[model samples]
Target chain A: MEKPKHKLLSFAYFLESSKVYNKIKKFVYDLIENDEYKYKRYFDIFMIFVILSSVTLLVMDVKRHIPHWLDDFDLYFVTTIFVVEYLLRMWVYSDIHKIIIDEYEESSYFDKEVSYYSLFTNIAKNKWAYMVSFSAIIDLIAILPSYRGLRVLRVFVLFRAFKMLRYTKSLTGFLYVLKNKKFELMTLLTLSTFFIFIAGIMLYVFEGDNENPNIHNLFDAFYWALITISTVGYGDIAPVTPEGRIVTMLIIFTGIGLISFVTSIIVSSFNERLSVLREDRVVQEVGKKKKLTVVCGYGLLGRLVVKGLQKEGVEFVIIDRSEEMAAVAYNDGYHAICADATKGTIFEKLGIDDRISHVLCLTSDDIQNAFISVNVKSLNSEVYVTARCSDQEIATKMEYAHVDQVIMPEEVAGMMGAVYAGEPVAFEVLLSIIEEKEKTHINEIAIAEGSFLDNKMIGEVDFERLRLILLGVFKRSEESKLGEFIFNPSDEFVLNAGDNLVCIGYSTAVANLKRKM
Target chain B: MQIQKDILLFGYGTFGRQLYKNLRSRGHKVKVVVGLDDYVEVESDSGVDITRINIKRNDDILALNVNAAESIFYCAMNKTANNLFLVLTLKSLYPQANVIANSNSNETTRKLKYAGATSVIDLYEATSRRIVNVLTKPAVSMALDEIVYKQNDLQMLEIELKENTFLEGKYVSEIKFRQMGIILIAIIDKELGYELVFTDHRINHKLDAGDILVIVAKKENISKFQEMLKKG
Candidate 1:
């Protein structure tokens, strides 16, 4: 019997001293610090719901009588959770202390391993520091018990709602914005205070207790001044004299302007903060997408490309050096980052390298486009690049840089002129195709491995019956041979599994073909 | 057709002045229309001449005798929307006259075309195309340059054969383009849904009725070819 007891005690000692303790401590630390943990995220959501309901019950209890059992049940349940969270946080801090000591030792910050007594003292100091932290104080207040019949102590229960602020990133960002604009806000506060004080003194001097029976004391005058300045006008106090009335009118107008000024300051700061948050959201969203197009410029050509991509429902991010242009793109419902695209790290920062399929450099400047092309290639060599060049020299240079396509607007225009001069009707048809204004659309439909069109002969399929014209067939094979484009193949031509049919037909007919494929 | 009066040039910016000089050098009379707010007297860079006219109202456009002028070139400043509006207004006024305008993008080019621009010169695209042509397709570009820039009067014509035409069932070699001094660039087979065949297949491929021929030759030769095919 004694041996068994001895063994059980030793087992308990081993559990406490083993790495299992540290692993469990790390798990709890992750729950507190990392929101990516699935269980932790669910727990956080559940806790938020519980806190909200508890606060609502507390508020309701103030106005009406709540059942004692329900109130007690809520208070006890939330307080118990709060206590457990607070203790867990403290335990994690202790684990952090051990980690710090180990790091210090590894770095030779201390010449030797510290004595047990010294380590204990250091941990005690760390614990003391954590106890005084703002969150820790709030946690303690949340779990504080209210004595029975001590009605005033129950107000501390509302402190539970403040815990929600810790989990809300946007609220913290708002607080940060407020802190950044503290000087401006303080100036407004000072101006309003001086105005109120002066107005209160003038009102008291113009209508003292002798003339106005409602005027009781200096504090009453100050209260009336505040109410008037806020435009609340509770109507509990009034000035009888004309001078006081004139002063009140002036005060009312000043209050109106000052209030608007304060509101404008808050609103502008909030908007600035919101843009920053939106930029972060864009980064996060880009991370989620498996394929994206990064447009490096927001000029006329860039805007046209963006519009086309938007019509096709393609995911893209616009990058421009001009803040105004970026803002314009953003307002136009595209994710835009205002940064120089020449910087190699910008792509990494935006996670553009993760799954970027295309990099379109459409800046007006040829040198900028070249730089962007090179940077994108260096960042991800597999990404296809298309750039706009102003001259033939730049086009050759871009081509040498392995850019897939170098477009020159002037050269294309000259070609268009030549085409117009040579074949006017054909030119119009081409223009209609590019403009997508014609009822007939030239669409490419791929034949899947088991598709109905796969392995079918051209003459076997009745395209005439469907009102679709097969313009070309691009056969892509697995052996890495260049795809062959058979333009208007013979009736005996066989359709392969990997063939992409470029058809010209009405939009409805094309849709039907797509459905059939 | 020779113009009796000077040509009217609208919007005397850089492009306008360049057009004025080019027309003047080419022995055509030229007049420039500046904005109403512009100074009446302005010096040219060459210090040889200055010509300016104000355009404040619609009558100003009419006063220029736009219909009688050789052509009106709207090489205004870089305001595409305003240029489009100007082209629309000009087209409304003189629907029969040739009015060429400059555009920036493909979209604007299409808009300008619909707005009745006789020839829309997208300067960027034109320059790019010229550069690309000079670099990649020198031979074709040289021919196009001669026709487009030099005004060689060479024509590109498409002819569709009728049923029972002599060309039916005849190989492309039988047409004898070399003897006729014409180039058969491609054949558009109607049976193949108008697919363009431009390879050596045209050398021995049997021609059929309703097969459209895309050929490039002088104006008179095209008509001669058509008459000979009709007689056959």
Candidate 2:
């Protein structure tokens, strides 16, 4: 954001500040690289078709006289695509305009001339970094098959197959598993190298002269040793002397031990990463949805809230700190993750975007719930958050954090106990309705504009006919612009558009009433 | 003459103190009893009688006039064992006393129900469920809060129908409770296996004797409705 010296001539800074350029760059980046992009699947599928046909055509070009048109197609049409794709990848690799502007600004601050040479070198350095990256190198080689002089490099056209690594996820997942087991794999590599060298030297010394035709030179002996250690048992090269056979036997046992060690390491690492992969898939799935409810705990209250949400048929994702509880929720057939809710980037990882409508923080710890609510409101102020607190002081803190609702379980329990003590049957009557234990739920039906219920008198809607008990109506007041609850509204209460009618009834009955509206 | 102390609270604890205050604020004549020596000494108020006794024993329970009291609340806070024993002893002795117990968990609620408690409040489940209700059904919860949980004249009163009542032989569709300006939420009848039959049930149930009507209304309206039921 630092202003360049004399903005007009500072073309780099001017380009850097252009919003359209940045947007286009981001669009192309998402199109090619962002896995969570909605349209990337179709893009990848198209590229897979292109890659298969290109490789198949190249393979057949050696013997069968492919039509000249197909050869020209591979040479011109395919190479142009490879070159353009490589360029686009390089362009989105990093912001070269920013690099040049930063270098220019630093040089000006030092009271020196803006050396165009330094800026050029800086831009080149960044481009080189991306060009040497693993995927970029594969991309560069994929274009080499078009050159006639580099016929040896033509064989490297098969390196085009490695370019498929960019499109396929399983290949990258395997690489990630191997990368996580690098330390154990390195140890195994060292142990195998040591044995291969020792066995190669002994084999040449014992069988090089006459006992074995396969062991003429040190290179041949080393190749035999490697094949034996790999447990391939090609048997093309066999040891004849007693000493060589003894070394072969020991190396074979070592080979088995080393192979098993490598397998277990990779398998365990994959097991550890499977949960991560599954969560990533869940996040991707959530990205495609809107108006998702994010439940931030998997405790008793969280379970109850999730159940209510399920009954309401709302889409929701859950996050909890305890792996066991999260696993319990996941096993209960809910999409849940063991993750810290207060982490700044967690919202993005959950793929909530701006579409998260509500967040329910029901963790046992009051401080954690408070922070979770605060974090959610910070990310999206429009999201309604309900947080649980154990005491009044923390409840006030939750309010300051702009939480929509603060639930104090102990205080609510105390009030409930009192209510039960004074009017036992009344408490049961209300609680049965509230808890839905009686198979009846309290629902709010909003009167849509121009609907049958709109602009009608309350008396016109027959309560006995609908078979739904009307509790009250929450009318949106014009002056205050807030919904006010009118308890036990009388028959004179005129039904207006935007009025929310609260009622108690069986779920099916409520749905029936809703259909009428 | 001494005012009738109609309510007895046993095993005073955190929830016990709150319940006592709530009952007192609602104009109920209530007394507290605790077996823990320290709780009795510390929480005992001068004006309110705080009796210290072994509530687990039947003799001590009877000594407190457990059966004579209209309602007995066993609020042992976290001690489920004492609550179970107290409920069992009082039920065994009185055989008809209304015993209400507060349990810390659903498991304890089941045990208390089995031990002959007339009503068992699962504090944990209630707290969690209230939070859930507030979260999932904001508008409905706020409406319920105004009339039910919050302090107001509006009350939920259960009126049982006796024989020869005007509404006894009428079908549910024929009777109009809403004409009295009270919402009849549900009907609990003994012959219906004690399950709450919501007012919105598809079947047009016939109103019979011994059926209790759960109605929500203002205090004066409730009294008016009771008088109308009695006269008609």
Candidate 3:
């Protein structure tokens, strides 16, 4: 499936032939469009700074006298950067030579001469698409004011503020909210325009000529109608006639109606986005943590898992459909969001494939857990997913979906009952130990590279003196994941770096041993 | 030492089957009762006795004789209504029998208790607690799996101190359980209404007769300790 890279023919592939040129072009493309690139974020911040400073200099020039050097720096230095940015954006929009050669190579089957003309159009189309793009137009006009030839268009420098939209995300979110309600806004705009036109004509008829000195002409009547309908009521000119006064009341009432209608539309748009904003905040918080566990339910089981995870100091997000349940987790100061977790695309939205180390499907409904585990495994095959099922049939389905850990609560409860009946005291001891209520724990501490415990033999550290029992060691190697647990390791066993020491002790003893790790 | 009791379990589902296996493996004679329509999984174990009856009729349940059973489990995790009715019927039938009901939710546990189940095992809470342990305390869960479920030499036992036992009248702080190759978690005092007073701290309480001590140790060490208690 590998494509042949050798260039066969002439000047059409000349630019593509240079590997360095292609490499540089790809880097610029990444800077311009790739959201994951580190330099792209830095580039955005620098651009934002340039736009802000340029706008600030312009504002200062309006009243206070800015230094000439500062003015020249703003007018020339900022314009050059804007021009360079525009050119780079246009260049990265599409690879011109690749398009030309690809079209030429394809058209060799048909009309070769016609492919030349088509190729010309193809290149023009790509460049023109970039040229007329909203951001592109803003980039161009933002720099045109610095040209001595375009002094008449000097006011266009304010477009630099519009350029700020390209860098900031929250500003773009505002535009998205308005764009979603475009249809309703347009209908309202049409209705208001119709009322304004009719009111302007009615005012002209009621107060034309000597009937009212303010409404001498149609322009004046229309201007009065505009001011009255907007609820501005400049009162520079008033209609003295009784008919015109009635028309004024109608215009004022219509303004109030349109204002309320517009207010409702905008308010509803924000209301819809408010939930999304909270979800986004949770998503952003998840992105910050190194190891994240995404629990898709906040019921009783979810609360139990959350408490254990909290004690372990693990970063996790709680997602639930019920507001009160999610609120229970949210109020507890954990990252929680009220949203349905069974949606197909929800895992990708949560960025589970990247930072999530575990996905817990703890919803009570078996079918819900199945759907969630399937979604999680589909998104990230490597992520360890644990799902709780109530029965054996659904447990089979969950395992079939490739869940890493399929938990049957009934089976667990049955085992608990048997253990309790057989060894009630043992069950109580194990339960308290598992729940960590008695400050006893069986914990694992990883030996980091260059740590004090690294390269030390197991016998060197006095685990007995530390009041802990060494259960085993989990050595991680590049070949295997998490490695295998070596049970009852010999005293002469050398403790290497990146080995996890599994021990059973009180929490303080574990903490003491971990101090060396 | 444990005197294995006869366990009578009613219902046929995942919970019932699982509990059946668990109790049977613990050397207890288990009798499983299922409805006529129940699909029972085939097992050839001689220790189990399965019977099919139309449990829908209250007279059939009333006529059912489980007088020999000391321990009864009502596992209607699939049918909450059945557990409620069965627990009520059984409570009337055997007033002093130990009836343990397995329920999927907390609310069901409460309702089963109201119907006179001596104890209700919350299926959700138990499983969730296990899962939490598996995730947060992997080593602990692994150790339990090795010794407890795997039936190894090392075992956990709860010893109820008999009158004039070795541990009687001794403060909890006076004993070093770990030196005997045992881990002591708590002491449940019968006089204090059976609360688990953790031994790690708050160790001022005197160990009384009839108080239960939860400890984990090897089988031989446990037997030796119990022998010492008997001779005390």
Candidate 4:
């Protein structure tokens, strides 16, 4: 019997469904961190979508604004889906005991207590949760008191469609404004309400007589005071007495200060959110996604290697055990996973056993490389491995492990020392230039078989016109005997078909050479 | 003694307090630090005794300013703008001082180095160095690189399930091979984490997109596993 196609498609479906949940989580984080009223813009957009969808569903269900029909089934179906969603959220929360106690055993007591707070904050944090949560509330609003007689609330479900606007950038900006200035605005609101109350009471006493029709009771006085403070003078309520007129004049001047205070609060709030939004957008745009390359130990030598890789535009992931060092890397916009590399669990967590292409072991200890080389080969034999060793013994052992390359740091260092001693002027000149100007880097290009230089000799290649200096030629010929160091040879030294020419010059010079060639 | 190429100083205290410690670490030659204080003392690595020196005089500054060993790092943390002013003023007074200051921005690196830093090294680059360090020593597999494993006698197998299949009960050790190979490491069983470590043995663990199996054998043995799914 053939296996069910659904069973085969289950994994893909599972991933596809989880994508929505992941997107929701990302949206929430963006919402919390968003500085602008981008949330509000998103909310507006989602609401529009919701409204349109609702209208279509309603039109399909009712056909006419009359009583029930077969079309009414669509409204019931959508409402039923929403109801199931609400139940699932509550059901997911029911497993809270297992989720917190089982999953978060290492968490502190305060973290456990605040874990509940995380749920609520998470609602405010994500775009979908923030939207769907409000939508969920609206869903409840539409579903409860399920009597056909109450049609108005059901119609309000059409407005609930606007809830989808939670996904848009502007809605996020709006929410950001609300979130950041919540306390300040709350204070301003309390003061405004209190002043309105005081004005209301005083006006009620001062304008008690029937001379002023608008200021009949305490409620009317509040209405007038609210209008005046808000700078919206409807002129609907006027105080007739001389004392009442003086109070009104005083209230009008207070309006200016109140307005300025509220405006200032909102502008600063908006500015803060706007800046954060821009920063998030930039990070998201710049951060590339590739299978992570886990760098285990970061020391002096490691730093240079990393800098070179970064310059060459390689996407690599880093794992350093040092907390302070990790903080610095993270601050610089590098995704650094902090864990011990020697452990099998870290490699498993990083998904390196399957996805990795190469492993570079450059720790100070040669023994560690020898050991890790074996582990990496055992884990994934197809992966290429390179190790750094100062000890020749360990280097030989590493080679036995099939390490593609073994770099000897001590040997390189000795070579450099000898070079400096023998050619002090050359070494000093290079170091001074690198330190002083930080300009003019080197480019080493190889001559390919198809190139114009296939049969040409050194003197005929127009080296100076290309504005490049041929430092050396790495000849690969059975007839001749030069490997990587054939320097300043005679003009008759033919550029072999597979010879690699090492040229050192600035980037512009290399570009000009390529263009000319 | 060879001059240290790159040295990082954490704090900017009195020149004397930092200078002597640096001198002891660097030996006799002048040392520079970024800070406002001036007390020089050379303490043992044991951190038990302290020797103080009064080098507040102009001679000391001039000596440190010109010494080839002197690479001063400004350690002030409170206000970056103030730190810039202090560093630039010191540079103007002593153009020979190879000044290195803690900076928050790229613009600051340019301005400080231009103002007169022999060369400005970002303390953050130390952070960058840490990342570089990690990259250099990436988590590597031992078996894949070893000579015992690399010879034709050994092979590494990474089997991924394109579709779900029931093959859990069969012993991996008993699996027939097209060529003689050994099943040394099984990654998929461990990747599910500690919960499924050794319990509820159904012998048939269904494979998924994330399911990975690492097997080792001779070169000829791997083709058998590949052929089970009908490759050739």
**Winning candidate number (DockQ):** 2
> For candidate 3, lDDT tens digit of each residue in A1-517?
1123233234547777888888999899889777656688899999989988887887787788899898889878898899889999898888877786787667666754433467678889989998997678888888887875855665776898898888876787788888999999999989988888898888888778677776678888888888888898899878787888898898899899999999999999999998778777777767667778889898877877787688768788888888888878888899998877777465666677677888899998999899888878887789989998877788898888899888877677777787766666666666666545466666777788888788988768876567776666777778864466665566678888777877766889878777866
By TM-score, who's the top model here? 2
Instruction: Report the TM-score of candidate 2, chain A only.
Output: 0.91
- Write model 1 residue lDDT over A388-478, tens digit each, in one string: 8866677898999999767766444434433443344444443433345556544566777888888888878876567665555677777
For candidate 1, what is the TM-score? 0.63
Q: Is candidate 2 or candidate 3 better by DockQ?
A: 2
**TM-score, every prediction:** 0.63, 0.87, 0.78, 0.40
Q: Where is the poorest 10-residue window by lDDT in model 1 chain A? A: A414-423
Off by over 4 Å in 4: A1-48, A52-135, A142-148, A151-162, A169-184, A204-209, A213-219, A264-288, A291-311, A314-425, A428-517, B1-232
Docking class of 1: incorrect
Candidate 2 per-residue C-alpha lDDT over A373-453 given as tens digits, one digit per residue, 9 for 90 to 100: 989888888888888887667889889888998876656666666666555556787677766666777787888889999
Question: Across residues B97-154, which tens digit of lDDT does each residue of candidate 1 receive?
Answer: 6666777777888999999888776554444333333333333234444333434456
| Candidate numbers, best DockQ first, in rank order | 2, 3, 1, 4
Pairs with steric clashes in candidate 2: none
Q: What is the lDDT for B74 in model 3?
A: 51
TM-score of 4: 0.40
**Candidate 2 ranges with C-alpha deviation above 4 Å:** A1-10, A17-20, A58-65, A148-152, A351-353, A378-380, A420-424, A478-482, B1-21, B29-65, B68-70, B73-117, B124-136, B159-181, B187-213, B219-232
- After superposing candidate 1, which stretches have Cα over 4 Å from the reference? A1-45, A63-69, A83-111, A114-140, A145-153, A166-170, A186-264, A277-288, A319-350, A371-383, A396-404, A457-471, A479-494, B1-101, B105-116, B119-232
